[model samples]
Target: MTRRRTHLRTTPRGTLRAVTGLFLALTLVLTATGCGGDDSSAAASGDGKGTITFGYTADYSGAAALAVAEKQGLWKKTGLEPELQVFTNGPLQVQALRSGDLEFGYLGPGALWLPASGKASIVSVNMLGLADRVIARPDTGIHEPADLKGRKVAVAEGTSGEMILNLALREAGLKPDDVTKVAMDASTVVTAFSSGQVDAAATWYPLIDTIKERVPDLVEVSETKDYYPKLTFPNVFVTRPELARENPELVKKVVGVLKESGDWIAKNPEESEKITADFLGLPADRLTGSTKHVKILPSSELTRLSQDGTVGGWFDRLADIFVEMNKLPEPGKSTDYYLSDLYASAGRTDRT
Candidate 1:
């Protein structure tokens, strides 16, 4: 539960060079059509006056904390009429966004990369801080990251949870091949680990809490710190590029509302916890610990996180990791290719 500090260095020279080339190419594409052209009229609006279909997916029945956030009408409080969907995993939620069935939703850091590079023009508008944890049962004998070698680890394939495991392995001076990875859903990871099916499990809250409740002597190994300093800022709010350009104002409103709701949560933790627990159908007592760990960074923090290539730099590093792990097709351009205007608009200094 200790906070890990990350020092953000300036973007590496090679990354900057590649970003420069990509920026020029993008500029050429934009200039050919006239630089100052505005597509505001082409954008979609809400139902007549103030209703829009914001989309969201979570294992509401399973992951109580996320479910609580959704069921509490936090998005609605943020002026978004979210059309909620339930998905078992992050990859499936990203797929829903790619198909255009949903315009925007929460996603993992890894899920944002490929779609942004390919057919889906996704932009990370807000970042929900690290909500995942890595836990090992007492019987498994995994006292630390180094203990994971040759042991069975259950992870849901293509999730930020799985990606965290990969990053942790590298941090521990091991490789993915060094352990036995058993792919399983979030609900089953703990049970699988308890039954000796796997030595450890990489999963998020509720599950981690559940496992710890069942196995009190379970060892806590490397967590978000083991990965990119701050758990790679796993849960992020993302939208498609076309949607953002067409309706920048709406996007701005959505972000503004989320910021307000997050602020409210920060001020009224006990009430917020009650709302979350009731919505997720979990005991209010269990809510205190889980909610305390969920850090909702302010919109200003999100703005700084996106600016000066911090977000881009992280993506580049993630891409390199993906390639090294052989998880992606190839490393893609991180700067010019990803959208930043939403954060720019959200943090606009001159609103007049």
Candidate 2:
């Protein structure tokens, strides 16, 4: 059965539907493999033939590379019959990949922990996390991070929004418990904050713009970009390890698509944003400042980062933060999940 693509606005306004049955799916796959399946090392196996179901988040900025690939015919140019699916967040995409519902997907910081914890393999690092922000209603008088103390702030736990909020609170010498955290999905954050049900909200774009449009005077109390150097957030590409190991050529082709689309996006920022805006049914002007929020590095730079272990270090640091927050039992082994050789395999080494 083909899963229908979900757009950001299409999900229920105040609900974050959990993708249940992950354990069941994995259990079934493992049982099948043990019973007399092919000699594939991983539970989920793909021949890398036929239509490739690609998953991406449903936002103009997050889907920029994919939208470009689709619009410019890059997928077919690379000999891939692509089926693009839109997910509301990274965990859902991860769930699909584990169940063989998707061959590849783009994930944000919120879901990066899954891959780091051995849920999937990281093939590429595509986008930087700069869109996360905490916006407060002017009447709340939450001008600074410390002002959040005792006030209700809507933030989705286990997402980038929580990371941004925690880092901000740390800088302000405030603890997580200092403020009242109103846990909600990204969609509900907008509704709860706009209705004055919460004092402020922590989220990312294009939802940042969405919230601003509702409360014109919302204050940007904190943003992930402000915590750079000490902290870094990334959006990455992932696939099942079994698929990458068995069909290296297919994985290489997908990497090629990522490099091609990323290179095109880097050289043509304005045109790329326009293409993404049109693809997402959003007005071009709404994406005016969106390009600056995500650092879409060129292919050469990505290769350099992968080779030097810089990319792996990024995940390690993120895992440390999660561990401190008690989200993970321990820090994940970056090398275990991040396949560093894929960049060179895709031939993106030339620093052009």
Candidate 3:
């Protein structure tokens, strides 16, 4: 495969610079306490009827519920005036939450450290790890997991991309070291793989779209859905711990809205996708196949998953991975991050 020259924004040099910034930001989050001012008491005493800011990434599959909720006036129906803000990734949302700039956020496994470090709290789960994939160049002779041995595989070191890569390699009776690993950010990996700098890349959507657009002969390889419940990487909704504790009523209301929105999306996927695309200012068909790639659980399912330890188990497994990668000092219990009582409280109310 010939390398294609393009003016992609995420270059190797830029990513290298980001590595240190990412590390320091994470370090600060872990080491600091009460990063956001003490506003829980003030927010809780109020009637919980005001303009609240909901933060999310530009990812349609992850934040589709928010788009639908806003467009359908669901929040207003419940006496909430919400303002949505889009961020580039989950960590930034965590920062905003800590700084008291945001009330709620939708995030993926990449920001699980927020909860693990007690920097934020996971209020609910959004979806499973369906969007991540391991794709290869057609000319690389790498058609399957077993074919990846000794080949250069591009993956972000500690993100879901690496998790999927390790899982795929294990299934093929191969170790991570069996393949030549190229450490890069998820976005940078997309450009590198498309330009023939790496044989395969473990990344997720919209980035995958970039590779598909630039490289015509992309090979089909493994995806996160293949492992399903065995290896779970969850996209989740989070809020500050103080908010969850001081304002249980508000939490219940938000959860009810999320449930209503998720149910609507499940029943009317076509309309939901269009709403998300339009809200994010993308092509109408940009999220066409997203349903198959991201398993969005209806808000109603949160209570069941919470009661049965399913959601908790997913986070526990994720924490195990973090420990293995030395990102965590030790494994964290699911209760340390997951607020299971929120689901139970939301379920008890008729609002949901």
Among these predicted structures, which one has the highest TM-score? Answer: 3
Q: What is the C-alpha lDDT of each candidate?
A: 0.53, 0.72, 0.71
Q: Which stretches of candidate 3 lie over 4 Å from their true place?
A: 1-43, 138-147, 172-175, 213-218, 347-352
Better of 1 and 3 by TM-score: 3
- Tens digits of per-residue lDDT, candidate 3, 30-60, equal 3321222233333345566665667765555
lDDT tens readout by residue for model 1, 267-333 = 6656766665544334555355544545555556656776765666666666666675456678787
Please tell me which predicted candidate would have the highest lDDT against the true structure: 2
TM-score per candidate, chains pooled? 0.68, 0.76, 0.80
List the candidates ranked by TM-score, beginning with the highest.
3, 2, 1
lDDT of 2 by residue, 50-142 (tens): 567777754544578887887777766554566666666677777878987777888878777788778889888887878888789989889
Assess candidate 1 and give its lDDT: 0.53
Which regions of candidate 2 deviate over 4 angstroms?
1-50, 137-143, 146-150, 191-199, 210-218, 278-289, 324-326, 348-352
**Cα error, candidate 3, residue 5 (Å):** 35
Error of 1 at 17 (Å): 36
Considering summed lDDT, which 10 consecutive residues are worst modelled in model 1? 12-21
Q: Stretches of candidate 1 above 4 Å error?
A: 1-50, 58-100, 119-131, 137-141, 226-231, 276-288, 320-327, 336-338, 347-352
Candidate 2, residue 294: how far the Cα is off, in Å: 2.0
RMSD of every prediction? 13.5, 7.8, 8.8
